[model samples]
Target: MKVGVVTFPGSNGDTDCIETLKLVEGCEPQLIWHKSTDLMGADALILPGGFAHGDYLRPGSIAQFSPVMREVARFAASGGPVLGICNGFQVLTEAGLLPGALLRNQYILFHCAWTHVRVSSNRSPWLEGVEEGTVLRMAVAHGQGNYFADTETRRRLVEQGQVAFEYCDPEGNTSGESNHNGSVDSIAGVTNEAGNILGMMPHPERSSDPLLGSADGRVLFESLVRSMAAGAVGR
Candidate 1:
């Protein structure tokens, strides 16, 4: 599998995302520049975390207009798999590739720590191998990771199984202070209607290796690889 890792001007986790895909999935990692129009024939694409354009005009507001995002948006429209993490999630929302918006943490402070998220749905290719109600230990570091959506959108998201993950306790209970951010319905991640695009606030690349404290994140990456391979066979 060939995985593309997008690197914006201020992206800091590009290397980590690249290494995780290469080492864990044994897939070819392509470094895609934010200014380029080419996708390098990537089988899957990842928009890693970090402050794009120095987060000058709100998290992903500036990065959404980059040249590369044009192709990324096209790829997603054609059913290509796209994963956005942390600030990347903001970009996806800004680019209109995903629903809802990420707002400032309720506490108005940057949250940086490990938290548990339950697999709310496995309808997305990114969470194919992950079981519903499974708890994953992942790290989230961001100031605007809170997720919000209007009444209808939120209801449709749940009714359509677009809600992929939600902040929860280690035991899979989705309530209380377990939600580090004030995400609506404790949502931690969501997928597009087609289920090919995923936007989440947690940093999966940071927990893909057991040495990094947890290997649960690998489940999503591996699921992507498997989904791509299956798609190739179907084609």
Candidate 2:
């Protein structure tokens, strides 16, 4: 499988994402510059986390209009797999590839730590290796990870199974206390209606290696690889 890891001006996790993909057997992941017009024939793409454009204006606001985003948008429209993490998640939302928006953390602070998350659905390509309701250990580092949407949008997301990942506890419980950024309904991640694209305000690449203290994030990339190999269509 060939995966493309996009690099914005301030995207620091692009290398980490590439390295993680390298850990997967038979997988070839390359870096795609923000200014590149094409995705270089990658089967899938990953938008890793960081302070793109130095987080000017907003987390992902400036990065949305990059030259690479145009291809990304088109790729997603054609049912290609895409995963956005942390600031990358914010970019996807701003670019209209994913629904909803990320607001400032309720506490107005940058949070960096190991967080528990739960898989809310089996429909997402990123969650195929993990079962529904499975718990995961991921690392998060962000200042504006709070996710918010209007009532109707929220309802539609839930109804469509677009709500893919939710903040949770070690016991696999999603409660107010486990809501790291005070997102509505404790949403940590979500997918598009077709489940071809996913955006979440967490750093999965950072946790892909067990030596990093957690390997839960590995399943996400592995799942995507499995989906592409099987030519699985969206649910």
Candidate 3:
């Protein structure tokens, strides 16, 4: 599998994401600059976490207009798999590739720590093959990781099974302090209607290796690889 990792100016996790894809998934990593339109024939796309354009215009607001995003948007519209993490999540929202918006943390502070998120749905190719209700230990580091959508959109998201992951306790209870960001309905991740694009605030690349404290995040990447391979066979 060939995975394209976008690297915007000030993107800090581009290398980390590249390493994760190569080491964890044994996939070829293609570093795509924010200014380029080429996708290098990548089968999967990853928008890793980082302060794009230094987050000068509020998180992903500035990065959304980059040249590369146009192709990314096109790729997603054609049913390509796209995964956005942290700042990437914000970018996806800004690019109109995903629904809802990421707001400031409820505590008005940057949250940086290991957190648990339960798989709410496997309808997305990114989460396919992963058992529902499984608790994944991943690290989240961001001030604007809170996910919110208006009442109507929220209802539709739930009804359509677009909600992919939710902040939850180790035992899979999604209530109270388990929601570190105070996101509405404890939402941690969501997928597009077509289930090919996913946006989430957690850093899955950080936890893909057991030596990094946990290997739970590998489940998502593995599922993505499996789904891509299956798609190739079907084609």
Counting clashing residue pairs in each candidate, in order, gives 0, 0, 0
Across 1-235, the per-residue lDDT of candidate 1 in tens digits comes to 7889999999998999988887655588889999999999987889999999999978999999999999999988888889999989999999999999999999898999999999999987788867899999998899999999999999999999999999998999988599888999999999999898999999999999999998788888888877777773121
lDDT of 1 at 165: 92
lDDT of each: 0.90, 0.89, 0.90
Error of 2 at 45 (Å): 0.3
Candidate 1: residue 140 lDDT (0-100): 87
Give the TM-score comparing model 3 with the true structure, all chains together. Answer: 0.97
Q: At residue 57, what lDDT does model 1 achieve?
A: 71
Tens-place lDDT per residue, model 3, 1-235, is 8889999998888898887887755588889999999999988899999899999868999999999999999989888889999999999998889999999999798999999999998888789888988999999999999999999999999999999999999899989699999899999999999889999998889988989998888787788888887783122
Worst 10 residues of 1 by lDDT: 226-235
Better of 1 and 2 by lDDT: 1
Clashing pairs in 2: none
- Please give the TM-score that candidate 1 achieves against the real structure: 0.97
